[model samples]
Target: MSRKLSWGAAVALVAVTASVTVSLTYVYAMKSFNTKVADINERQAMYTKLSEIDQKTRQDYIGSVNEKELNDGICAGYAAGLGNSQAKYLSAEKYKAYLNGSSEKSIGVGIKTVQDKDGNMEVIEVTPGSPAEKSGIKKGDTIVSMDDKEIVRLTYGDALNKLDGAAGSKVKFGILRRQNAAGPSAEAKAALLSITVTRAEYAEQTLTSSMINGNVAYLKISAFTDSNAEQFNNMLAARIKQGASGIVIDLRSNSGGSIRGMAEMLDTLLPAGNTVSYRDKAGKTTVQYTSGPNTVNLPISVMINRNTFGVAEIFAADIKDYKKGLLVGERTAGLGTKDEVKPLSDGSAIILPVADYLTLNGDVFSGKGIGVDIEKELTSEQQALLVRNQLKGDQDPQLQAAVSALIRQGASVEKAPGTENAPVNSNAAATE
Candidate 1:
C-alpha cells in the first residue's frame, strides 16, 4: 500500500512539472514572435522612407552618386541636424570603433572635477576603489595641481586628458580639502598616489533632456554617440507633446559628438534638404540633409560658451545663418575638425580628418567658432549672481534669456502673479 501511494505522488508531480514547461514554452515563443514582428515593422518603415528619398533622385545625379558620396551625405546631414557639424564621415571600421565608446586607455585615480566659485577646481565625484579614492581623495576636495599645470584654468576635458597616460604610469597630484567655510586647508603634504590601472573599455551614457520651468524644454547633449540622433528625435517629440514653448539648448560645455547626428537633429527642426555641404577626398562636393517640414514653431535659444566645441560650432553657425533662433551667452569653442574614427588592427582607434566641413553657404567653421548675436557678458557681480544660482543648482540663466527674448518678440512671457492673463510687456522684457 505504501509503494502504491509513493508511485501515485511521483506521477502527480511529473504531470505538474510538464504543464509548467509547456506554459513557459508557449509564453517565450509568443514573445519572440512579437519581437520579430516589431523588427519587421521597423525595417519596413525605414525601407519606405529611404525609397521615398531615393525615388526623387534624378537619374543623372543617381548615376553619379557613388557609394562613398551617398554614405558621406548621410553622415554629413545627420551631423548637421544634431548640431555637431564637425563630424567627419566614418568608414565601417571607424564607425564600429566610434560605437564601442571605449577609451583607448584608462589611468589610475579615477575621478572627475568641475570649476567652482573663487576659481577653484573642486572634485565633483570620485570613482569607488579608484587610486584617488584610496589615497584620501574625497568629493568636494579641491584639486590644486596635477603634474604641474594648475587645475583652475583646465577645462574638464583637458583635465581628464592630462590625467590619462600609458598604463602602469604614475602621476603626482597636490590636493586641497575644504572642511568648512573657514577656507580651504591644504593637504599636509602632496599625496604621491600611485596605481597601475589597466586600460579597459567603458560605455558612457550620452543622451539626457528635461523640461525647464515646467514648460520650457532644455536638451543637453554631451557627444554625438550612435543613438543620439534617434534619442533626440524621440525626446523632442515628447517635449512638444508636453507643451514646451521656448527651448534653451545648453551646449555650453559640449565637446561635440557627430556631424551626421547633428544633421539628423536639424532635419527634425528645420525643413529638410541640403542643409550642409562638404567636400570629400575625391575632390567632389556633396550636399546632404534635404529639409523636412519645420515641426516646432517655438523660439529656440542655443547657449554656447568657450567650452562648446567640434560639430557644435557648425550648428551655431548654420542655425544663426538660417535666422532660425538666437544664439546666446559667449563665443563657442572653435573645434571644427571632423575626425574619422580609424580602428587599427590592434583594436586601437585613431580619429582622422577626411574632408573640410562647410556651411550651406560655403562658410568654414573649423577652428573658427560661431559668435552669438546677443553677447551677454556676465560682469563679476553678475557672474557672482549666476554662480550663486548655479551653486543652488539652477541651469536657468539661458532659459531666462530665451524666454525673455521670446516674450519680447510678442510671445507671452509668463502669467503675472494674481493675474489671469499671461502679461506681455515687450519693451521691459527686452531690456531685462
Candidate 2:
C-alpha cells in the first residue's frame, strides 16, 4: 500500500473512494426513512386489520348476508352506541308511515293510543266523527287484542301500524272498558267488549277554540302541526272580535310537532325579541326572534302536564320567560332538542338530535322540565277521570283553574258566581 503509484492509478483510486462514500450515505438515508415508515404503519395497524376483517366477512363468510341489512344495522348500532334516546333509525316503511301520520290527512281508524304499565294499548283519544268513535270506542279503553293479534306483544309502532289500514278496510279490536265515576267509592270495573271499525280518510283537527266565562277564549291545541299558526290566528281574531278579553292555551298531552309552527304562534303573543335559540355542540347559537307587532296584549295562561313535550314545552317556557302568561298543571316533559331526519339512499332514514334548545334567556330544560307556576299534580287515576270528564263536555278542572287565574289577573272576562271548579254542563257551555 505504501508503494509509489503512477498518475493514472491515483485518479482511479480517488474515483473508487467517492463511489463508496455515496453508497454509504444512500444506505444511511434509506434506513432513517424506513424507521419512520414502519412506525406509521404500526400506528395504523388497527385500521388495516379492521379493513381486512370487513373484506373477509364480505367474501368468505359462511352464512348468507344482506348487505342492506348489515349496513343499516351498523348505522343503527352506531347511533344507539351514542347513548342518546332521542336518536333513532327508521326503516323505509316506518319512515313513510311517520311522514303520513304527521300530515294533515291520514287514512286510519283515527285514534291515538298509548302503552300502559302492563304493556296494554290504551286509547288516549278517539277523533270525533271518526270510525273509532262511531264504532263506540272511547278514551281509556284498553286494547287487549287487534284482529286476533295480542297487543301486548306488539311495540308502539307495531300497534299503530296494526290500527292503520287502507280506506274502507275494517279492523276488529278487543277492548277492556273501565267504569269511571267521580267518587271515593268508585272502583275500576273492567268489562270486555269487541268492536269493528272501518278505516277512512279524514282531516286531522289539531286545534279547537271556544269562548269561556263569557269573554275568555279557550284554545286546545292537540299538536303543533303546519297549519296550527294560521288556525290559531283565525281563532284568536274571531274570539277577539267576539269580545274575548283573555286566552287560555291548553297544551296538555301535546307531544310536540312543528317548531316553526310553534314559533309562529309565539310571535303573535310575544313582543319583538328572541323567542328561542338552538345551541350546537360547537357552542354556536342560532336564534329565532319574534317579528312584527304583538297584537294579542290580553292576559294569557298556558296549561301543561307531564305529556307536554318538545315544541309545546318550548312554547310554555317562552310564555313564562317573557311573563306573558301563567303556566298551569304539572311540569312539562323536558325534551328540549331539535331532531333532523336524514334519508339514506336505500330508503332508510335516521332521526337524531342536532342541537339543544334554549329559551331566549338561555335556560336549557333538556332533562329538567319547565316548572309550572301553579303546580297541579294529579295521579294517573285523576288524569283518567279528567279525560273522561272532558270527553263528556264537562269543564276541565285545569282549564277552570286557568280561567280563574286569568280573571284574577284583571282580565275583563266574567266568572260565574259559585262555578269555580264546577263542571260546565254541555247544554250551557259554548260550543267549540
Candidate 3:
C-alpha cells in the first residue's frame, strides 16, 4: 500500500511540470510574432508617405511642389564630395557680392564684350578716349585668352573674375578679328595686346544737384541708395530756401533702388491723406500714405528714358497721376517688380520676384512701362552731336528734351556753350 502511493505522486508531479513548460514556450512564440508584424506596419507607413510626396509633385497645382526641385534649388546644397572636381565653389557671401554688383575702376581700356554664335567671347565696343581704344582694340575683336590662361571652356563669371585685381594691374588679352564675311574668304586674324589699367575709386550717388545760371537747379539721380535719401532731403531744403522757381529732376539711366526712398521723396512732394498702394504676391496689396507737409511747390519737369526703371517708374507715374510735374521725354524701363535674394547652401544665390508695384489709382505700372506726357526723340543731327561738345556730358536725347520742356513752361534757362543767362525759344537753341 505504501509503494502504490509513492508511484501515483511521481506521475502527478511530471504532468504538472510538462503543462507549465508548454504554456511558457507558447507565450514566447506569440510575442516574437507580434514584434515583427509591428515593424512591417511602420515601414509600410513611411513608404506610403514617400509615394504621396512624389504624386503631389507630379501634379501641377500651386499647392503642390517638386520635392527634388525645391531641395536642389538655392535653399539646399550638395552632399559631401560632390560638384566639379577642378572648380572651387564660392561661399554664400561671395555669391551675394557678385549679385550686388561692384564698381570697377580700370584705367579706361574700353573693351566691350559680347557672346558669339559658337559661344565665343568678342569685343563689340571701345570708347575712343580709353586706353584699349588707343591701343587699337576695336569692335569685332574676339577674345581668345588672357594672362596666359586659356578661356576655351571658361564661363562668363570666371572670365570676369580673371579681369579683376588691385589698381595699376596689367592684363594681356589675346584677340581675333574678322574684317568681313561677305566679300573676303580671309580667315580671322589673331592679335595679342597688353593693357595696363590703373583702377580708380568710383562713387555713385542717387541725388546730385547744381545751380546753373544762378536760379535753375538741376538734380541728377542715379539710384535710391541708402545714404541718398538723407542727402536728397538736405539738398531739397537748400534748393527751396535758395528761391528756385523751376527744377529739372533727371531720371535718365537711373535704375531705381529702395522703394522706401521713393515714398520718402513722394511724402515731400505729395499732400497728406493720400496713399500709394503697391501689390504683392497672391494679389495682396500694401499701402504707404503721405504723412508730412509738401516741399518745393514749384514748377517741375522729370527726365526719363528706357533706363528709368523700378522706383523711377513709380515716381514718374505718381507725378503724372497727381499732375504735379510734366513727364518729359521717352518711355520708362518696365521692370516694376520687387525681388528677394535667396542664398543657397553651396554659396549660390537666386533672385526671386516677390511683388508687383501699383499706382495710387490701383494701376499696374509694369509690362507697358510708364508713358511720357510729352513724346520726343532726338533728330539725327542732335543724336550725332556729343553733349555740350565735351568729352563727358549727357548722351541721352531725353535729357536735352527735358531742359527744353522746362524752358517751354516759362522756366529760366542756362544755355550751354554760346552765351550766359540767355533765354532760348527754339529746340535747336535748347539742344545746343
Best by lDDT: 2
Worst 10 residues of 1 by lDDT: 423-432
Residue-level lDDT tens digits of model 3 in 113-136: 555556556764454455565566
Distance from true location, Cα of 236 in model 1, Å = 3.0
lDDT of 1 by residue, 1-432 (tens): 999999999999999999999999999999999999999998799779877877677443536667656765665565555555443445554455455434422344566666766555676555555666666677657766666666666654577665544445666666675443343764444343322333323334345576555566667665665457787888877877878776656676677766778877877776545666767678777675556776567777777777788777777777777777788888887666546665645343445567667776776666677888777655555444333223111333444565565555444434321222221111111110
**In the order shown, what is each candidate's alpha-carbon RMSD?**
24.1, 11.3, 18.5
Pairs that collide in candidate 2 are none
Name the candidate that leads on TM-score: 2
> Which scores higher on lDDT, 2 or 3?
2
Candidate 2 RMSD computed on C-alpha atoms after optimal superposition onto the true structure? 11.3
TM-score of 2: 0.73
Off by over 4 Å in 2: 1-74, 114-119, 122-124, 129-142, 155-157, 165-170, 175-200, 387-397, 416-432
Candidate 3 residue spans exceeding 4 A from truth: 1-94, 98-202, 238-243, 273-276, 288-291, 345-347, 379-397, 407-432
Return the TM-score for each candidate structure: 0.55, 0.73, 0.54
Residue 371 local lDDT, model 2 = 92
Q: CA lDDT of each candidate?
A: 0.61, 0.79, 0.62
